[model samples]
Target: MLYSAKDYQRVRKEKEELDLGRSQFRRDFARLLHSPAFRRLQGKTQLFPGHESDFFRNRLTHSLEVAQIAKGLAQQINKRTPAFKRRSIDLDLVEFAGLAHDLGHPPFGHNGEHALDDCMKKYGGFEGNAQTLRILSRVEKKIQAAIGPSDDICGITPEGIDRRLGLNLTYRSLAAVLKYDNPIPLRRKKDTPLEKGYYESERELVEKIKAHVGVPTASTKFKTVECQIMDIADDIAYSTYDLEDAMKGGFSHPMQLLAKVGDESLLTKLHEKVAKEVPKVTPDEVFAALTDLFMLNGADTPALEQYTTSKMLASDAKMRSEFTSELIGRFMRGVSVTHGTGADIKFSKVEVAREIRIKIESLKHLNFLLMIMSPRLKVVEYRGYEVVKTIFETLDSEEGHLLLPDDLQVMFGRLTDTDSKKRLICDFVAGMTDRYAVEFYSRLRESGASIFKPI
Candidate 1:
């Protein structure tokens, strides 16, 4: 095992009276499963907007699928590798990481994430991954604040001062989700894109988690073997299932992709785009992967009939089920582990083949070009940006403080720093669901509405 028994213990002491026979890892999974942050994922966007159709997946369903894939990948590695067999990976920890991975994504998906990042560029830039760390460490309410006798109690804080321990999760469990260890820059750099990392405010807490997990203070590596498994599982789920959702929503079909695969100009564009990340992935390799997956050459009918017939085939429930299952199995079986030479290292690192990795990336690029970059979706993204910006501006105004929830208003008053106030407002907006954000925006713009209506 990568971690010792002590690493599985929580920072805060467990209640003696409530002690259960369940393992510590299972307890960590249970804590994440019951969190409000996890529940809110149901209303957040995944591929398509959540309110658009019941057919499309929201963040919650995606997380569940990712968890399933993560556990399956862990089992595959455990069965295949001798090192992993000797010191088995914890299935529960892998699942916990996958489930908790996307808990920080704001409403409207990546579009909302970009907008929030842009808004908070000067106040320690926002990123969904960083927000995930924040949620686990300080946003969600699981641990009670350590209080002083004379201090005034506040929302989320039992005492007037913030203690910043949200779930107080076990170090190993927390380490599984610390996908990025670097801190978000306090100032934006010229010509650089916004990136995902932990918040600088939580630097000390991250170090403490690392220490408890037995990671050396001077070690440069951030992710553990379990974290790597979860990351790959996330990629597998995103590439395959998001394509499934897109196909179901009439965005793209395998036959259409088959046709595109043969187009030299389009293939050139795809190669160029993907090579920006993976330079060794050749155009022929991409074409071969697509052809193998879709059986492109086997379709002999006329082009129009092929398009219509392929759409019908794509719409078949049984075919979609089998296709996704096969894809997931193929990817899962590709996982393998490599042991490090050091005598102190107890666990081996996990990896997938380069071909499989590139194939997954190719599928993601196809999804991006066909669904995400579509003009129709861009309109929705634009409107979502306006909604988020408007809400932030409204709450930031002097008189607009009255419109905030009583708890937030109290928090705003208690926090005197400009950056802190902005962060509080950003949190309020970021916590909103897709439908609630629209509803809130509508309520704000209305001429007259029920004064009793709660925000």
Candidate 2:
């Protein structure tokens, strides 16, 4: 076996019963599925809310899809590689990683993430990956504490040590969740708001995962194979699923989006317009210079074999580029969600192959340009940050912090500096649902919204 039960560290004390040769990692993955933090994902955003439309996916749905895809990929690779087949990667571990990957996302999609990152910058800083670690190891602790001897409650399990606690997952499951290697408070200080990995609040959990895996600190810099599976599953889902959502929203037709690619005049105009607004670039000339030097100059490369061989193959290289561009354009128009049987699973390998991953990523960069960093989005961001900031202001106060459970409140008091306080504040904010955040803001702001009302 690639990894034995001993290769994993169980967070909760276990009696070492049920020596199921499937390995302890599989059991750990199962525990995560039953955790409250994982359940919270059902309410969080994937691209948009579930109420927006019937076709789009939320984080919970997305996580499930990623798990499926990761399992398929792991199985495929294991079957293809002799060594992997002999002592193969565990599918359950990868699936669990994919499922629990986004357990830390704040409400309102990436908007909430950006808002919290900005709000907590003075504290310890917030990134989704870091926040995921925080959720599994800490915020979930609060949820456990809230349960408080309530055996009558639904969804409560007392399988291991610390009955009311975080997902006490095995180390293998946790290791698969750590996609990026960079530590919190990023090595190079920047204002981009996105970090390569988790926060300082999760140092202990990180250490535990690493120690259990027997990975050297330096070797832990990249993702494990399971993590890679999860990451690729994420990319596949985002590239294809987001495209479907964008198409459903009617921002731009799939075909129309494709036509814009490699069109010199259009590229020139897009560069001019986008450059003026993009934070990373100063002017159209600079944008054009950068694009040509990097993307455009390299665009005419040979088509990947996958494109040539797919059932819905693009016959010409130019057409292939156009199809890829259209796919991205279709995805970028916008996103919404609705309730349905969840049967839409069509995906294009030509769109997400290694050769096209970077290109697709470049187009999704518009997510930064048109949606995330756009001024209109910034207005929403401003409001979100303000809401979070005000919540922090209230919660960090003597009385507000006291309202929390004794342990968290004590942790808040024990924190000595602005950074620590901010992290505590993020812990509070990150745990909120969309309606909860709005309600909390209203209550704190005295917005005349009824405190007795349940959303």
Candidate 3:
């Protein structure tokens, strides 16, 4: 087998049942599927708030879409490449990567993440990618170690250790989601709002993952094929689906976005970005690409340059769906496997064709600017930042561990180290969904708060 037995080894050794027929990766997927962290995703924000319209995708739906795309992409590569056909990318593994990819995004999306990072500047800075690793290794309460009768509600820990084992997932499963390998610093040089590495708390587990997965200990970078596919799937999803939400929300349409073509500054920003990513694409090529991509229905190109209001909604639901489907198909056609640095599965990288990537980047930046940066969403984003920050502060206050739920409170009370305690509070606050975060903040600070409210 190309993958060694160590790849399937879990951190805490336990008696295994007879194979019966399920793959280890499938078990990993099942574990994540049934976890509270995964379930919380449904109430978390994606491109827009879930309550505004059920048609808008939440984090849960977006994750499911990513898993579908990642598995499909893996199949496409395996079917086309002889080497990959011989040592096929595990479809279940890629799907698990996709599903677990966003498991660490706090309530209110990036806004919430930023709030948590700012709060943890002195402790290990918070990052969604890093938090994902933390959750898989230690945060989730699937397995607990040997503990006193008081600590274990069920019994003296089944794992026979003295720590909480997040999921006791296989080493390969942990490696699949280890997006950024570096341990996050206590304080960044620039104090960036977000950091892209794992927390110090999971440092030991991460090292074990690398050793078990056959990645060189000295390697500076590490990203498995499945993780790359999951990342690409995530990009493809938000870029297309978020645009669908915008159109459905009556925000703007393709032709209406032509107005952006007139903004030389914005176009230059986009041109530089496209040029950087796609190389050799000129400013004129960018302008032409924009017009070619969005100038549909034989719409007069020159008039749309003057198009302003979203009221010019020239497309219907059928048109939007067709456009999105065609775009997604184009992206899929662009994918292939290529040689890469590092060891084992990390030795390969997924490449999206330049032309298709150009379209993807264009559409992504357009969605980010037009929808994510829109004043309409900005108001909510600002509110999200405040809510998340407030909740973190309240939970970290004097005697704050008292407010945590019984399960979290038990963990928090046992920690004596300051950093560990603060991290426990950070985890408590970061695990909330958008709805829950709002309710939490309201109960703490809002007037006429009900004591009957349940977290």
- Candidate 3 lDDT, tens digit per residue, 175-263? 88887868888766445657788998788888888788876434356777788888889888877888888889888877677677669
| 2 or 3, greater by TM-score | 3
TM values, all candidates = 0.91, 0.70, 0.91
Compared with the true structure, what per-residue lDDT tens digits does model 2 show for residues 26-79?
Answer: 666766777776777777656545666776677888899778877877676666
User: After TM-score superposition, what is the CA distance of residue 25 in candidate 1 from its true location, in Å?
Assistant: 1.9
Backbone clashes under 3 angstroms, per model: 0, 7, 2
Off by over 4 Å in 3: 146-162, 189-191, 216-220, 272-281, 298-315, 339-346
Per-residue lDDT of candidate 1, residues 269-350 (tens digit): 7777778766688998887777666662354656677667567757887778788888888877777877653433433566
lDDT of 1 at 355: 78
Model 1 spans with C-alpha error above 4 angstroms: 16-19, 150-160, 189-192, 216-219, 261-265, 276-279, 296-309, 341-347, 447-449
Candidates by TM-score, descending order: 1, 3, 2
Q: Which candidate is the best by lDDT?
A: 3
Ranking by lDDT: 3, 1, 2
Candidate 3 clashing pairs, residues 3+ apart or interchain: 145-161, 146-161
